[model samples]
Target: MLFAIVSITMLSCGTSRNLDIERGTGYNFQAGHPEYRTTVFGYMDEEEGTLLEIGAKIVKGSLIYKDEDDTLQARISVEYQVQDLDNNNNVIISEQSTEIIKSTDQDISSTRETLDLNYTHPIDPGRYEVVVNVTDLNTNKNITQSIETAIPETQKGEYSLSNVLLDGKIVGEGGWEPISTYDVKSKVDSLRFVFQVISPQTDKRMEINTRLLRYASDTSYTRPMHYSNYSPSSIEYKGLDYDEETELQSNRRVLTDYASTFIEFKFANQERGNYRFEVRAQRDGDEEELFKARDFGVKSKNYPAVRSARELARPLVYLMGEDDHEELMKISNNDSLKKEVDRFWLKNVGNANEARHVIEMYYERVEEANKQFSNFKEGWKTDLGMIYVLFGRPWYTRSHLKELVWFYSYNHSDPEYSYYFNQPKLKNKFFPFYHYLLRRNNYYYTVQYMQRQLWLTGQILTRQI
Candidate 1:
């Protein structure tokens, strides 16, 4: 049965499980693929709040063959979480499975647990304790028992159908950790997609679906498509399988908001050079395609994955802050973004915690947008709000000046703002303010805002008052 979400729903943490069945390590592989191994990361049990939320990023590494290593590799979940597990084993649990979010931002750590898992139940964290159970689907025997962890666990990102190397170049960088790169035919329009299929080294002939796709040239770089196979720019991933049984990446959907799901990425100046990448979803199990091989790396910098844009806004089991973002995207790339984001703020607040006035002020501007320009769109997306956010407030006496002139003094710690008007026959020579005025990424403030600043500093260029 298809578990398609008909609409958007945000399941806040400490809530109820949205699905019917909630047990299984969420190992990524064909339902009955023999070689696939299932591994669980951490265990937890609580007896306090009626809500027990277990959240972390996760990933499915290649299927593990028993006896190859001595690491714990199985996860077990109860069917009716938040509810009391019957003292008698009478609760009928359904077969459990998992899906992988294809187009996820890679994490800084190179591990299989890139995605996070969160479970909120009617049962409080202080109620019945959780016991970890394990069973090898291959051996059909209880192999181990795990103790529930009391504290929250951090998760790594996951990857899917991203292992295959087109001509040895990875088209998709799977899971946040261990970023395996791929090569493509073109750098200009190299479309990237994260598919549901397993690694090419698997014997499972099942076709996996795609969840999202991104265009390298797009402003945000990521395009959201919950789950659909049809596409004008779709590509199929297929290759040789090593017939290994390893747990796959996690594809949990605690919420479905695009802004809440996607991560914001910056180009990490890398030694291996730059390659634009994007992700797209697949149609279904029956759809197929043929791709040619290509080389992806000549001499590249070694960079790993990190958190997505959404994770930064709302933290999971752990609160990842601005400093965390700095480390995650810091990749094997450059240091520009990190320094710039900091300098942008440091110019005003030498110390943030001791001075939170600006942080409060920035959001106030956002709230203004929410109210004033909320017609058919949001204020953040409006021309006025964009400028407001970029430049605090405009200067001088003109809201719509015929022509605006801005000046900056980099060395002397001085900046200036001015406006000029020269219209011979027009009553309003002003070019309808906010016309094509888009936020130019990072800026100190607007012309009017600078004017206000100068007025406060007593550096009015064209005024004596």
Candidate 2:
């Protein structure tokens, strides 16, 4: 089912985009980059002309940018879209955010131009559309073009994984931001978490921590050829009384009471390439053991650098307090609550009228919390829920602290932050004990103002909260 080639075509042309573009009914332009003399397609561009089992590939390669910004007096903007015309109802997936940019040498900021043009689509041999509409300073109107092509199917009973590269990262720091998985099969216990030291809250030169947890899982397992592999011995199965409605759990027993063996690894203090994570799996019996690896990188170069521990602890917002869950229920009923919620989503969309990231983030968070929260409670309605929804799940959490003290740490690489919290363990401890702290440099924000009351932000002492 995975053997599908994606056809591409220019979608629109307008004053919104500036450029000179051409896309014929069928791809006729010379393929590949002349300067590099590389092959037209990254892979062998095989477009089988079959409808039921046909795949087509297109390699537009790099955008040929002849910067005339100096004197040509030509300002251009371009927007593109490609569609599959074969099966009207079949879902056609195409890359939409690819772009090319040109700027003066001195304008070499992080906002400089980027070119991402490799596209793939599944379709039949027919008149597909490749639309690229461009606008220029000379005229206000934009031009649209289309291309048609046919694809020959691959040989019977065959497929390819030569160019397949599976890459992603942890939840915090927002790697693969809009991506989430409820399929237990897709879940990997230990992933190589990667991100830059851009957050003022993270230690730029800090070391990474690694932990291998003990679990009750079945020994037999199944995983993807490239994504992850199964270790029959390492997997402990959970009881059926628990609910795990994931697609991958169909034929296997579930796992519960999972915990990790705490371990930390140190990396050099130099900045260079993106971080790489590799997980080694041991096989039971005579199965061949193998290694799995993934890549993780951050998109926001100007990401807020992690704050110093002193800077993070400078101000204590609440000296002593209690988490009033009752306050949360009451505030949830606020008349203007919907307005605040709407604004939250609007900010993420960056476009209120056409915003979807808010909805996207909601589902993504819900799925992640459910999959992760079942360890002790339902994720959707716990303190973890309250926190994860706002900040995010910590990269590392430990139960070694007292029954009342639950430690949630993010980016263990940084040795500075000791982000642990003391919660309601003994229900009758005190009336107004410290719950949590949200610390800033000599300034603090109170979650108390939030509709739902959760915990105190930063409390390092028993004398306080």
Candidate 3:
């Protein structure tokens, strides 16, 4: 059972439009369109309502460097707006700032070096939407994304927990830095979570319990096409198989109203999967408990690269016939599976060199899909991930009120090359709000088949602006 039935609604296609990078509304935020990564954290502040922190990490290679007085430099602009969700999405706070990155080495942009930018703000307790916009000043290209956060109202005597923060110490790093992407890199052996426990009574003994659970399955498709005819239903929230648990007792002495503590969980040799980390706190004499949870993914050491035979075979649902894909997936032996996958590609392209090229290009799209569209399940398993892996990046992307549209051709008036996805009204705690459902139609069947034929014949399809 590699494929599961997905029910999705068929909506009328929308008008084709190009992304407006300057305005920041039409870009695909979840698809890594901004060429940067961002992470947000919220903390409880006694005086200020909530301390909101945004961390943006930009890879030097993604920036356009200009030579200035024998030195290479790049400039970036970051702007953010906080909107009150309860008040008709009114913008309550907005600010913009810029940073200049300089390098003496000319080849700096070719390396994996990165610049870290941090922003902090205080806001009242409420449900709010935070939109962060980042632009490469030299290129004038930008990306904008929005995330929903809730700040709990604090009471004097009630016990509460602040938002959990995930951090990791890289192999060479001296101190722990925030793992803002929530995807733990292969270089990290253990995960560190930091948060504050607020209690009313001084010198109170408390018990803290932590549990880690791993998802039971990965997002693999059994079907050929990504769209469905029925109304979309949420992905079933599979039970998280219990993996590990730990308990710590707080020493009965408190210097202030709240105590900050961090717990480390080792993930060395752990299977690759999505995991949930939960914490529960209760005072020794009281039954009331404070709890918090966060979800994250563990990437293979050679991340974004499909190394295993099973990983290589799964994405073939897009390229192989249903019967062929099913047979490939049925191979139980890893060695045999690897050989068969090699033979399939070699057979399709008719030569060893072309086979190698096609395999690399195909999986590269699969890897990019994983990085861009992953949610509760892997990105390639999602609707957007499927389209991305098959068709490559859309020539134009636009985000409407609750819908996301992508166009493959430069002709904005033609609906034939446009695809539409709508965000469902249903909500899931384990899923991000940005998840969208593809609008299926009979017309897509013809297009999907044509794309599959193009790939099988060793032809790469891409949109030229």
Candidate 4:
């Protein structure tokens, strides 16, 4: 019998401190395909509290376009809400808007064309929960996401820095256009960072320092353990180390006090890797300093699609034995690595056609994992990524106060098909904000091994029967 993959409902619990974030689901072979993408940015405005910016990008292919008056049209509805975290999650601000996109050419609907949206709101400085809801009017499909953010207070005569904004445009092209995905595509030659510096004194020199750090390696999942709920007392964060440090601007004098000044920095020729961009501000004769950082990744030209031999070999760790994975990693030559990969699949599956099918399905999951769970490190290397690539998407997902649970079977009472991942609260700067550690236990060993054997023996040919 072939393995059957089914649709599952993801349950999220709402709370002030621990806001539940949800991703859209689909009936396709891949899992958690959010219909649209939304990005939120908060910047401090000297006169008008905080400037909240929201950008939502929707692919035309994902929506249902209708024929109206011989023109293809797609309608989208977006709602924004801001809740005060300090006030029992009370809704303080809300807005709703609808957009209708009309296209005369029907071919645009089949292509990967996108509808870009931009919204800006001024809010007070405080801790709040921001929620964005997007709906495709044609299909009535909706996706919602909530995030908890804190806006720092900047008073008069106080030196402070606004939130850093990232844009893909090179210098002197046009105005500031924020890159919503944060994932810098290979086509972008240079990255532009913009921020405002609120100065207290006029004609005073302020030093701005910028540092870039690349993700090194993660050894957290080197050994698989039995499933359990025992939380670690102290979790040592791994991956993301200091790669390069540089001062972008030094001793720059501001001409005005009690006003906001824009500071711009541009960097070119970034390598393909996960990175953390940090900025620090300090004024002469001031003992206090301000700092901010953001996480972004420089993806390969054909990202989410694993084409390189090295990239293809890395995800094989989930299926290969420890010694075998180590041996494959030792092969530095690209040509030899590709040959070994082809040999490994054929040796286990016993045929080229079946092996090809298995390889295609396996890498497809890897690509989807990268799209869903990537932050600082590639998604396939993350704990959740590893489980996704191994067992496929869970049958059901439920979120708790601080933990996320995934069930492989419809029967929630069965512990045998359940997996638990804990989100530990860490004070370290190196760790990403949304990192989750898998609660490894011996229970997973047998099931995961059985699944891996199914792939190797060519027992599982497709995602579903």
Best by TM-score: 4
Candidate 1 versus the native: TM-score? 0.21
lDDT of 4 by residue, 2-86 (tens): 1101000112222321121111121121232225566655665436655766666776656667899999988888898889888
Estimated TM-score per prediction?
A: 0.21, 0.19, 0.62, 0.64
**Model 3 bad stretches (over 4 Å):** 1-33, 40-53, 66-73, 80-96, 102-113, 119-131, 146-158, 169-175, 200-204, 226-269, 284-287, 299-317, 320-364, 393-425, 428-450, 461-465
Output the better candidate (3/4) by TM-score: 4
Give lDDT per model, in order: 0.27, 0.27, 0.62, 0.64
Q: After superposition, how far is residue 264 of candidate 1 from its true place, in Å?
A: 21
TM-score of 3: 0.62
Kindly provide the TM-score of model 4 when superposed on the true structure, using C-alpha atoms.
Answer: 0.64
For residue 204, model 1's alpha carbon misses the true position, in angstroms, by: 11
Candidates ranked, most accurate by TM-score first: 4, 3, 1, 2
lDDT of model number 4:
0.64
Question: How do the residues 1-465 of candidate 2 rate in per-residue lDDT, one tens digit apiece?
Answer: 122222211222221211111111222222121101101111222253333221222221223334475522223344445455566623353333423345444333222122223334334433344445443323343444434333333343221111112223343545431111111112222232221111122211222222222222121111111222222223211211112222211111111212111222322211211222333322123243222222222211111111222111111111112232222223443344444444434543445434453344433454344333322222332334434543444555665433322234444544323233333322221111112211112111332232112212111111111
Candidate 3 backbone clash number: 4
Query: lDDT tens string, model 1, 349-376?
Result: 4555422454344444554443333211
Best by lDDT: 4
